[model samples]
Target: MLETTETATDPKRARILDGALKMFLAYGFSRTTMDDIARAAEVSRPALYLLFKNKTDIYRALASVVFEESIAKARAELAGDAPLGERLFQVIDTALISVMAKIAESPHGAEILDMKGSLAGDVVEGWRAAMVGQFTAAIGEEARATGVDLAARDLSPVMLADVLFDGLEGMKMRVSGAEEQRKAVRGLVKMVELAIRP
Candidate 1:
């Protein structure tokens, strides 16, 4: 069943999503049944079904929660008075690297990546688009604050944002641990500093 408007704001629905996320991460999505989610959430099968129709629905909702929370946190960092490089680093960490790390660390990562006839993939794509938009806006703000016309340097805010995000995607593939991710963030911050500095 499709999600109802009230589902988004329902406390019980949030509980279900939380429980589902934990279960899905612990046991791969393929192994997590609706019964497991109901038990984890401490709800009856019928009650759980009232909130979400199936495992796929729960998974989609969980993915949406993660995506939205990350975007909100990233936007807060971006709007802060921190220096441009610092803000950019926080944005990348919250918006991109953390989500990638979560998936990589999960047993169901591959299944989530390859899931067919599911909305999980679409949720991730939407998250990426939102990240790009946040990054582009933050870059534009930085450019304006620094009086650096990105267009004058053969670039635009959107292009710079896309480049940084694309670079982070590549970095996420190669990094083996949190330390490596931190180093990658540093590298990205340096790149942005050099690109935007007068």
Candidate 2:
């Protein structure tokens, strides 16, 4: 079982997580031990142990922070009064591109892509489910506001959100730079606009 103690409010835990992320990105998960984290965090080994049990525990905490921050930003964008295209673009950039780019920009990018040999897979899946739920709800709200009935076209808001999310994920993988990704996202948003136009 993983430790679930609240660490977001604890400054020391946050510092530990920050240090661990940097170490993991720099040295890969296998090579980053508790001692390495302690040194990077400038915390004693005893202090680090009091906060986290092991490297995996620290990794889980770091993952939690990343997903939580990303989702919060995405939710904020969705709740904004901006036009649907701009809002949706911001959601894609926040939820998917930004998260993936963080790992890809790291020195141990390939290893991080493997997600510590599936140690973080469950965490990622949970984040994805939550994100999809949020996206679906946001889409439903927007559609109702615009009087666009997706059901008439054999589509639900959830289905549309899933399609858009998957499309963005694919596009992010294909594109390299931030500018290219933004262009791809804009193109996708345009297609979405055309698809739902009354």
Candidate 3:
């Protein structure tokens, strides 16, 4: 009974999110209305309203799913009983680049970049902060496992994570061109290794 219920709900929600993502990527948040999402999803506007209160709610749910999945993947990459440097590089190569590429290739990638001015809401900012926090927490755990003395280190976990995420965001643009993402990723992995060296 539970499985059937979830199976039914999951597809409908996914359908909505898929449609919204396309439209949001194309026209952006503010410009893409609920009516647009309904038409794109092939559902009635009333149905969309029943599923989501408004654009903000739908965006929050969608962003949460993406962010949570990325964080979980990073955690899994770092969970292996390997050297800290090895695990960190794996996390960067597999998890971070995966998320970055998804964003880069996504039609909504640029729209998402312009989200704040378009949505002009706190939910977006909150999600951005949450992503940073998750990254910082993961890095701190990795540093501890590696036996790095935090007090002696020049970089705080928060600062390190911030730089890492920001650096990737910048790289996503530069590397996304001419299929240079792979080369860019390699450069990033080397940069991380150099930064974490004892």
List the RMSD of every prediction in angstroms.
3.6, 3.4, 4.7
True lDDT of residue 106, candidate 2: 88
Prediction 1 TM-score vs. true: 0.87
Q: Is candidate 1 or candidate 2 better by lDDT?
A: 2
lDDT of 3 by residue, 1-198 (tens): 112233256877777888887788788777899999998888998889998999987787666566556556666766678765566566666655665555656666766756643554565556457656766776677667677765586777788767766776687656655246556655665565555565
**TM match of model 3 to true structure:** 0.67
Error of 3 at 132 (Å): 4.0
Per lDDT, the best of the predicted structures is 2
Which predicted model would earn the best TM-score?
A: 2
How well does model 3 score by local distance difference test?
Answer: 0.67
Candidate 3 segments whose C-alpha is farther than 4 A from its true place: 1-11, 25-33, 89-96, 106-108, 116-131, 173-175, 178-182
Task: Give per-candidate clash totals.
Answer: 0, 0, 1
Q: Which residue pairs in candidate 1 collide?
A: none
Q: What is the lDDT of residue 34 in candidate 1?
A: 92
**Tens-place lDDT digits, model 2, residues 85-181:** 7888888887667767878788886676677337777888788888888878877887787888998889887887788778876885688877789
- Candidate 3 C-alpha error for residue 164, in Å: 1.8
- The full ranking of all candidates by lDDT, starting with the best, is 2, 1, 3
Candidate 2: residue 79 lDDT (0-100):
89
Better candidate number, 1 or 2, judged by TM-score = 2
